[model samples]
Target: MIYTIHRTNQPPRYRGEWNDTVWQHAEIASIEKFHPQSSAFRPKTEVKALYDDTNVYIIFRVQDQFIKATYTTYQDPVYRDSCVEFFVMPMSPERGAAGYFNVEMNGLGMMLLYYIEDATRTTQGFEKFTKIPQERLRGMTIFHSIPAPMQEELTTPLEWIVEYNLPFSLFEAYLGELRPIAGTRWRGNFFKCGDDTSQPHWASWSPIGEALNFHQPDKFGLLQFA
Candidate 1:
């Protein structure tokens, strides 16, 4: 679950480390033992996150006896195999509504799907959607423990480290304006998937109750900007 600290005055310049200390297994039922239906997948992994003024840093330790990703068509949902993803929704009622920004990574260390737009609309117009360029979206890089292979062994466990420098400019574009303060809270979620499994392991920075939908920003926890 996501841990949040609201700042009424000045937001803390968070340079500390954060991780999933609650559930560290691949059984969603283990997490659901406490969180109920809000749990998404069964991940035998650990993810740590950190943030500064310019960007947020994330590291994932994924343990999979079988890890694989089949590259399908674009915008087809990247959760088909072992992957890590981040979803961010900027909260601003004045700018119509909050939008979604997603970054996904497959086990081959291939980075795909950095999509951003208003949550009210569909991604069908992604190529035509010129609000954010492909360069800016793919600019955020990843430093992986393993590189892509012509063929991969699904029996080995894989670990990955990812770093993202999300420009304030992108946030401004999505929000349709700019602000002075560097600190603010945004609704967000972190997810992972296991290929062909009957159930995929899932978790969020915020507890989303009994519902499995991560699109509900209202259920998101506070992400204090510093």
Candidate 2:
């Protein structure tokens, strides 16, 4: 799907409604959250996105009936808690491998992921880039709050919103001189982890087959730059 931004506006606050069509429209809405049996746990999440000349913006509204997060080293691969993540791949006509960027956020707002590719090498017939920089990573100003007991009672569900702004400059090094042009398409996916379950559910703009993996950009949806 080629998505065009009607305008450049700040993020919108939710008005307490569940409507997928509203999300599918030009406006943003609460994305239907689901849990996959692959992990036996699921969290309710709503996501909305927008794009402009300089960057792409995304907002994720996550609801965790039971909130929990576990922290570890950068590459430790800890999956036992609540966290939100986004994967962005920038595609250029001349480039074979798109620029890979990822962001993962925990309940306490501890974010992790390399925003830039610092090194690359051919490993086992596959090219790999390692040691990306943290400075290249982007983040949201909105912080999730641990709601008070009474507030939790009034709402029944606890929701947290995460916003992001990914700049086009980050792709410059990967693309050399080339840049994303109109009608250009890239692969991407939005994922969430919950309650240290080791299995996280995934929602993507472009659907992959039975096995869900966002690393495959060729299977990603089309993103026509405007």
Candidate 3:
């Protein structure tokens, strides 16, 4: 499973619009492989990615139901809400070295991100991990179709979009300079989940053999930057 990240000379405006001219040329991938534990309700989730000189842009469209979002603070657990996640390893972990980064965002645009060095499951969480400080993400831009702090669940059918751009400098801080990203290769996986929604479900772009885990970097698909 390889997804090409097309080069975009014209950066996206990050307005959460999927049909915009800049996004129309980008290839789309669907997050449809579901875990056996997921409920019968499965949302139609689609993702597209592009890269410019400064940042990597991504957008997610979810035709969903049973939407809910309560966590609003940075670094909070946003996976309990109607959420989309992107896990990427800019550089493969050779031996016990550089690890991957997970960016999880709720439907309302609230996000949780971490730099995980060791993903060994521990009582507190992973054996070794660091929450990417909010300050480092200042250059990142996010857009959401729905307003935030939704404490109540809405079971009606609806479509929501989440879009964001992550500056190359943000990744450079931890993974060193990622300049000349074109022609580069990385490993990543896209996911859609609602842990506490009325109809809980887990879906992924790259199929995961694990029962309910998204930390398997070996299961990630190839990301070819064009």
The number of the candidate with the highest lDDT is: 3
For model 1, the superposed segments whose C-alpha errors exceed 4 Å read: 1-41, 72-76, 92-97, 112-132, 150-153, 177-183, 195-199, 209-212
Please list all clashing residue pairs in model 3, or write none if there are none. Answer: none
| Residues forming the 10-long window of minimal summed lDDT in candidate 1 | 22-31
- Write down the lDDT that model 1 would get: 0.48
In order, what lDDT does every prediction score? 0.48, 0.51, 0.89
Error of 1 at 33 (Å): 8.9
Tens-digit lDDT track for model 1 on 1-226?
4433221232222221123332121112111222344235345554544444444555555655455565533444456656666666656645534456676666544555444543334555343233345555553545555455424435554444433345545666556653323455566666665445444455544556686554555664545444
- Whichever of 1 and 3 has more lDDT, that candidate is 3
Q: Which of 2 and 3 is ahead in TM-score?
A: 3
The residue-by-residue lDDT of candidate 2 on 1-226, one tens digit each, is 4344332443333332223333343443333334243344455665565555665665677766555544534533333446676666676677655456656665545566544343233453225554446555453243444322121212234676655556666566456554555566665556666534334455444455565444555554544454
User: What are the per-model numbers of colliding residue pairs?
Assistant: 6, 4, 0
- Please give each candidate's TM-score: 0.62, 0.64, 0.95
On the 0 to 100 scale, the lDDT of residue 166 in model 3 is 80
Residue-by-residue lDDT tens digits, candidate 3, 62-174: 99999998988998899999999999878623322278889999988999999888889999889999889889999988999997577689989999999998887877788
Error of 3 at 89 (Å): 0.8
